[model samples]
Target: MTEPRLRELAVADLAALAALEEAGQVQPWPAERFEAVLVSAQHAVLGLEDATGLIGHAVLARQPFDAELEAILVSPARRGEGLASRLLAAVISRACEWGAERLLLEVRAGNAPAIALYRRAGLEEDGRRRGYYPPLAGARREDALLMSRPLTEG
Candidate 1:
């Protein structure tokens, strides 16, 4: 594996990003959605792409006083490679630079890996939304775990 380098996602990367998200996320954002985000000042889309291709990506929304981690996806084949953490750090750095005081995100309750990753990155569970995720098959629905991290020493 080549060393993963992070960069602001370019328009050409949308197809690869969409594929990665569709494979990794339960409800992935379509390519046009990401494309729209890329052009907005309120959104920051970052990607980790090496010689092979895009391995991970994160979409964050910039607010006046906070930032929201809207979506994060790492190719299933690229898990456990620390790409997620790197992408997260990049997003956090961008948010901090933009003067955000906190970072927020919602994760599927059943996504243990993502929950663990966010926890390790200093996020704490602050709330929950029942039935936030639609059922995949049967009557089982997934909750949404709200997580937050303070951006500055307080």
Candidate 2:
């Protein structure tokens, strides 16, 4: 696969982000939510684009001492191409630049690929939330695995 270009998302890319969220997330954020995040001072959103289109993105929320990776998604067809890793790297770099001491995120318990990617990015399992995600089409609920990575002064 060719290397994708990463950039700060533009207004035109919001629709593509929405589409990717809908395709990847069971309980995807509404379009307006993404729009607000894009414009909000506290959020940093990055998009990855290839020849096909927007392939992946990561949204992070900044606080005084920490940043939370609120969402990360890659188009299903583009998985296994390291798009997720690239997105994660971009978010972490932004978080560090924002003076964040740590970066945290939660992944659905069964999302092994995401967990592995986070682990490879130096995050560790810090905790878990039981029944954090609503069931998909049934009564079963999903747990969420909380992970965190600390940033060092450079």
Error of 2 at 80 (Å): 0.3
Residue 2's lDDT in candidate 1: 65
- Best by the lDDT measure: 1
Q: Which 10-residue window of candidate 2 scores lowest in summed lDDT?
A: 145-154
Model 2 lDDT per residue over 29-95, tens place: 9999999989988998899988988888889999889999998888888899888888888888899
| Candidate 2 ranges with C-alpha deviation above 4 Å | none
lDDT values for all models: 0.90, 0.89
lDDT of 1 by residue, 1-154 (tens): 5698899987878788888888887677878898899888899999988888888999999988999999888988889988899999999999999889999999889889999999999999999999998887575888999999999963
Root-mean-square deviation per candidate: 1.5, 1.5
Each model's number of backbone clashes? 0, 0
